[model samples]
Target: MSNRLKTGLILLTIAFLLGCILVQMFTQTLKSEITTLPDGYHNVLIRVPTTFEFCGEQVPLYDEEVKESFDKELYINVFRHSSTSLIIKRSEKFFPIIEQILREEEVPEDMKYIAVIESGLENVRSFAGADGYWQFMEETAKEFDLEISKEVDERFHIEKSTRAACKYLKRSYKKFGNWTLVAASYNRGMGGMNAALRNQNAISYYDVALNNETARYIYRALAFKEIMQHPEKYGFVIPKELRYPPVKYRKIPLDTTINDISALAVKYGMSYKTLKYHNPWLLMNKLTFDKKDLKNKKEYILLVPQNPPMPHSNVLAQESLQMQKMLDSILHEEDTVIDIQDVK
Candidate 1:
């Protein structure tokens, strides 16, 4: 055989060998990227029956419009995994207090989910000067009987803000004569919702065309209700033990000025940060004596931590339990429950 022919054949052989090796490497890497699930990883979908009642009007979920809106929220929330998961996690920490307040106020139980959509259950301050889980502006907060001032903004107080929200919802219901409209009015002001109703000549919140946020508001609430009610259907697998536990506290009525909050916290066996964590409404490091209160004689309520849970105690506990279960099930290791002793 000629040397040229021999070289060409050898070169083709080398190229073929290189291509095969590269293909094998790529396949192995892809396989590793797709993590293998252990036995029992797949969970059965749990379906919970849901029916809507708005302003004493029973709305059937099977109705095409209702189903469409419900489906829209369900699909969106299910696919938006991160936000939904966070909402689920936070609900454990905040929902009990919110639910209790809602019950006391005689507000609809479903309305608790409104806070989830409003601030994801965080004490967040909006750029537009709205603050708290319920997102109350200064004037609005004061109008709803929430104290908003330089030293204190009770809008950050979960209980106070929720009560304010209930009042607002009640007022909205009175104006619109519909719970759906009341919910929508939370996004679009009562005046705006009413104006939209008049302009479109539609009485129903579902029928009315609205601005972008208002349009999606009710659907978001419905979606949250569906996903939260049936987490497994939406691919969420949070164990019962993985849910956040409620924090305990005692209320202290303060009639006098606190010169040093740090000292006050230390006196109560807590750090300054801990005091602030529980009482986010306390905006200042030092509490000033209100001269007007002395003449008028009003008392300030301070939430003193009796035995507050450790920071991120609920989240850490949940994550640890989940990881332990996964580790045991996947690795064929013995299931061991780690005792999370209280840190606070």
Candidate 2:
């Protein structure tokens, strides 16, 4: 072989060996750094408070069984960091809306926490066919006077569903005569709770021996109330700005049927997705009323952006420009150097 060719081959082999060594060093360094945590940064046991209350009714923490139940729930929620963190973040957005409705309905202000435990302040449908933030079943939702049709389910409507929940709570309060029983009955159903009380001869919820879910129901709510109220004590240190912000919107009240919801969104200078985000109760592409609904002149409210959205095309164009700028910056940057000695 020529001297020139031999020299090139040796140089290439040396470069490959050096690259492998550098990669090995980098991997080991990364592993060491990640495995070592700073002092005092570790999971710790949550301390149970001596006293607790729900909606002004005191929890019987003095009872050993009840105290253990409370401790179990607190440990579960405190250690379930991801779920609890999101719940705290979302509470900032939704709690104000719920608190107002509860106050206006004369329900205890602490009743607002029920929604947090119910749906995590989300518009989610449960596996047992319960729907929305309040997790109302179809029949119960209708009984509470929330409209449930093909194109719209008012249970998914935040403001309307909250009012409906208030109605149920008020009625339950009249039946049970206390906010604590009313909260319990929300989980165990009014009729079921009544039967349980009659059979057990128990007046207080604490005195009843019920099914597992119904048993843990009040304690779970209480646990969430404590952690959410004093999150920092449980080691949740989310910043105020990191919490979800409340959305602002203007309501468009209409009794007329809409043939094409997408067209309506375009007319309002927004996309159909944006419209649906604001009004999740709109379940279909088009909305129509039957003769009965038309005769009754049923009204529906559609939430539109407070500051109208830019046209969909404009938004796409802006996003495209931003993406292109990012790519350009990455492509045009100077080469990054990783010194082998710096790896450790």
Candidate 3:
């Protein structure tokens, strides 16, 4: 190549490299500025209560480390506005049922916050294979006498799962003799919690060092309890009318297998989508009973809606109007009819 051409190509390559470096430098500076907090808002204020209790056991807020841990969790939860607000709204719908069950099982009502923390009061599955509102693993769920079959998983059944959780909590209380430890044990398995206690020679949960997830678990539950109990104090003010109301439904008991759930839903004047919402435990479109279930005469309870939600779409509204028209036409035709014997 000619010297002039070679020189021009070399200069172009150098300019390109310099331009790339400059762009990267500018991007890094922009990121650093974007992440910096605005002036005078450097630190957040989260007020930790002077005294706190979990299941009526006093939180050792006097201990500096425990106080700091509690403060951290409170800070995290207080700032989680959207999640915290939705939880507060859902609490209205679920708490009544949970509280009654807890009372019947003689478990502490405060323990309900564990469910809030575990699944945000929703039936959700974890990456670790824990499922349902209570976050019970398949093995533990079965051990607690919860049914986990292909056709049905009772862990998603709110009433039954809450009962199962209470049973586990009572058993844990028996083991630890302390609700706080039981809460800790719920995160770290009972075996893991025992091992941690033995290895650290620690009597209380606050004294023992734990894995990050387990360490934060109890504090998260406590934070939720504190925030939910006094939501307005934390800047959450969900209106009374905005809260989710408890679902209204009637239970139908059946021993026979349902070969076509869609047809059954149609028979009840509901959509398959509506049926699934009330009976989330019914995992598939159709539910079947084994020969053993038939022989034992096992009865499965299905929740059919007494008051289904109002139609939100134009199509659904039209369908509802048509159904009402059909009903009215039948009643009108009956009123106009005369018996053959009366005519004669």
Clashes of each: 0, 0, 0
Instruction: Report how far residue 205 has shifted in candidate 2, in Å.
Output: 0.9
lDDT by residue for model 1 (3-53), tens: 999999999999999999999999999998676667645433433246765
Cα lDDT, all candidates: 0.81, 0.89, 0.89
* TM-scores for the candidates: 0.75, 0.79, 0.78
lDDT of 2 by residue, 85-133 (tens): 9999998888988899888999998887778888988999898999999
Models sorted by TM-score, best on top:
2, 3, 1
**Clash count in backbone of candidate 3:** 0
- The better candidate by TM-score, 1 or 3, is 3
lDDT of 3: 0.89
Model 2, poorest ten-residue lDDT window? 39-48
Writing each residue's lDDT as its tens digit, candidate 3 over 187-283 gives: 8889999899999998899899999989998889889998988877787777889999887778999788899997888777777888888889999
**lDDT of candidate 3 at residue 298, scale 0 to 100:** 90
Task: Please provide the root mean square deviation of candidate 3 (C-alpha atoms, Å).
Answer: 12.0
Query: Where does model 2 exceed 4 Å of error?
Result: 1-45, 290-295, 308-313, 317-344
Model 2 C-alpha RMSD vs. true structure (Å) is: 15.7
lDDT of 2: 0.89
